[model samples]
Target: MATRTRRAPPKARTTSGPAFEVDAARLPPLGMPPAEFLRDYWQKRPLLVRNAFPGFVSPIQPEDLAGLACEEAALSRLVAHDAAHDRWMLRHGPFPEEMFPEMPDHDWTLLVQDVDKWDADVAALLAHFGFLPRWRIDDVMVSFAAPGGSVGAHVDQYDVFLLQAQGQRRWQIDASEAMGRTAPPLDFRDDVELRLLQRFNPTHDWVLGPGDMLYLPPGVPHHGVAVDACLTFSVGMRAPSAAELLGDFVDTLAADADDALRYRDPGLAPPKSPGEIDADAMERVVEALNLLRMNDPERLGDWFGRFITVYRSGGQVMPGEDARSRIEVEWDLQQGARLHRHPFSRMAWRKAKRGARLYVNGAGHALPARDAARIADNAVLDGPLYASLSEAGRDRVFELMREGHYHLDLRQDDE
Candidate 1:
């Protein structure tokens, strides 16, 4: 099979707004000293700026965004209301334009979630915001709202930055603590709208034209209604809960284990009435799971990194012919070849054992080592963070990166 070549990093396009510049010089240095705007105001409160991206045009056009919504494979939703009846409805799509003729023009929205799944251009736009660790990076979700379209008062569990690419939107934000009381029902309808008890205007509210941006911290209750046809890109952070981690980690363990780890029924005898799962059995199962989680920290990190990197997108990367041939080659750690985690990926923990070798995406290799510094550095960095490696190391790293099993150092691209 033909292998996909790595595309050259695209040139950084200039935008007009000074606030939107993400270069290192433009950003506040570590410690986020008291004077920095982002350190002082971000997520703690709402920030609105006019001309944030001065010359910024919508990365993806509204029509194109809509076109994506019409694909059966796309994740899209339509929110609409009948002003005459004061009734609201949400529809999932594959939508056709004709569905909106009867609804008032400005009272609805068509949202295309996870734009990164469909548009590589949008994904690149997301990459620019990777100031945070890539492992915490979440997918980009885009919404095209018509006039007066709103998504009711809601609070997200993770941080989000709302970037206005075109038109204007009126946003209302409130303390996230008020969410449980103010939030509309999961199935809330227009007739029984959950009312917000507290409200705050954008301490910096303004008509956001193309390039404007708003950053909101998780748990902040906010609502947005378009004042005109608008396109909004929501760059959200991923905040996985303990339950989600347990589910995925457990699934990974089950896949790796050849022996069935089924709950053993002690076959206990007679009580007056039969009951659901016994307490003793439950304790045994929990103990077994705890044992699994308590693997050597370094080994755990290697396994978790490989598991996360390979399945980050819910897609699998199978070995190719070249990969099969190169499987047994010895890798040089001193030369600096390393398997780096995806920016947004997360690890439950790390556990290392003797002779523990990591098979990335089930194709690439990360040889085990005894050096704590090297292991930590290699696992934590998004791409390679070390300096130049020996030619053999570079070749090995290149082959893995080429196979989409790892990411090499950014500087190495020039070499």
Candidate 2:
């Protein structure tokens, strides 16, 4: 059981922020390591880095991002003011040219969402942060904020790192406690769509130039205004609410319900009226949901894992054409085989059972009795780790990765 350590340059400490190097070693380890940062501040504070990505190329150019706004296929927005003085305005695309009529070059901006969806290069750029669990990884959102352009003050439920690739932007962050005390209901007006309740001034205010980055944990209120035109890449983390979990879980249950899954109301009496959903019926629904939660935890994890690993709509992975007949191939977990959950994926209430079994795409296969330990080790690893396995285990792992059930960084290429 040898851990596969990432060999890269160590992160260089800077007076202003975290060291910026292309290699993993140069950057702080992904996610908040418990020992490095205290628990309260780990996912609940703001951190600023003067230089986060050294030698980093702007993943999307400002002009290129603007061009994307013009295309119908792109998700863009325009936010501007229409008043004679002290006006506030905001707009989002796919936008047409008329939306920018005589627009002040400095006060307007075009924000494009999900750039990683279309650009593989940008997506690969993000994969470098896989030091964090793939399950918690969210999508990379890009905003080309122009001077006077702002999304208004707001709080995000998930953690985010704002990486400045070009120009300068002014940012203001407020603690969650302060924001909670005076938070206002979100308003969507025609003039100023997003409103802020608290005012913020950076204690360490300075223009963030290229390669700088800012990290904000969930619930921290923050707002950014472009001091000049700039490109900001947001690496957002995923955090689902209980309501969301229940909704998705219900959907999964409905899809998998057996033919004999009709609700039974054995204690029925002569109804006073035609029909009604009585307390008994409601109780039955609740009971069913409870049953799902109480089911074998291992099976639940397998179900959720499958859902989490599948690609998003229109995001496809092609298996090697020559490997169509390769059912007996081997999978080397030590070679970087790991599960990558989709950003929208939801976690299940179930945890893997105390046995050696591999599940992918809603299907499960039992591991051989002797190799159970190895299989279990791979399944529970929070980060990448390696273990040698028999041919059967390898084949199963390879097949799963090839199907895009998860990602496998093969150590040896089979020619």
Candidate 3:
């Protein structure tokens, strides 16, 4: 059977005005000093902070989110539940615009991940979370649900901040440690498409209004049901499991290993039984595997730098179609042009013995620490910053720009 692509919803006009801002003096984004919150609640307990973004307004409307969901490259999902049968259904997108009108109004949700990468206004919210390491942030996932809509009770393996962007959602949580009790069994219902908890006993419950936020640490069973048509912005952290880390780490070692590096049985005593694997042989296996261990600090850091910058979706950052000379890029920047980081590019930097190395979309560039920091810290580069870069830094920037890690912002005038 031939597969047909669905038509995307019409693009909505971008929100006009100053980007979202947090007035720290009035009400902090975390409802208290960042350090205080980190010390008390971060990964240790759940917190319900009122007016985290006082007088908050959603950056994108439901329609705007629906439009993005229809884009072919979007990581989107539609979840619906049949309350009568206690059954749930899941469907991936790009969904057709016509599907929205056909959906029942109150029993389903539309979730789109990495909304920050898709919309600049949504990305601005990340600036307020400076208390945490920036690289730890996975992405901002936005979900729009009608009244009574929910994905069902579930637990996440990573930290998450559930910020109410519009309307209201009643959140129920079971933080076992904080409640001073044995944790609930981490079991899932086999019948549903979602990984919903088979059993949920929430000790804390609250209804979040616009600007309110809930911070949930890993392993907390929670559920959120929309009170009405609403949007929730989830700022999720990246917490790879031991298995995932080891897999990638070993893969890197295997790629760099020489063919000659192999297990040796110098003191070989033939096995008592040819079919039996002796303890001596097992010890040799352990010794052979130890060769792949990254003991040096620099080697460990280098491996992690490359690993973490890779997007969860494994999206590639392609260079611009037309590569420009360094001189051309410099001239354009001087003429009020701004260079924006590619949405798919994940970037990080590490200080080296000499200076630092910047990693973008799995590739590294050696440069001064200051220059590397500048690139990692600022997603958009402008004239003053460009001119301030050291000769080496400028050259690296030009190279990255040519490679499409950064591109000249065509929307600068509109901004």
TM-score of each: 0.61, 0.64, 0.90
Question: Sort by lDDT, best first: what order?
Answer: 3, 2, 1
TM-score of 2: 0.64
Q: Report the lDDT tens digits of candidate 2 across residue range 274-350.
A: 57877777998886666545276664666555555442322344443334333322234334334443322222212
In angstroms, give how far residue 362 of model 3 lies from its true place. 0.6
Which ranges of candidate 3 are over 4 A from the true structure? 1-25, 410-415
Residue-level lDDT for 96 in candidate 3: 97
Model 1 lDDT, residue 40, Cα: 44
Best by TM-score: 3
Q: What CA root-mean-square deviation does each model show from the true structure?
A: 11.3, 9.6, 9.3
CA lDDT of every candidate:
0.55, 0.56, 0.83
Q: What TM-score, to 2 decimals, does candidate 1 have?
A: 0.61
Candidate 2 or 1, higher lDDT: 2
Instruction: State the local distance difference test value for candidate 3.
Output: 0.83
Worst 10 residues of 2 by lDDT: 341-350
Per residue, candidate 1 scores C-alpha lDDT tens digits across 173-260 of 5432322234323332335343332333322223455566666666666678887888898877767777877777777777766465
Better of 2 and 3 by TM-score: 3
Rate residue 361 of model 1 by lDDT: 42
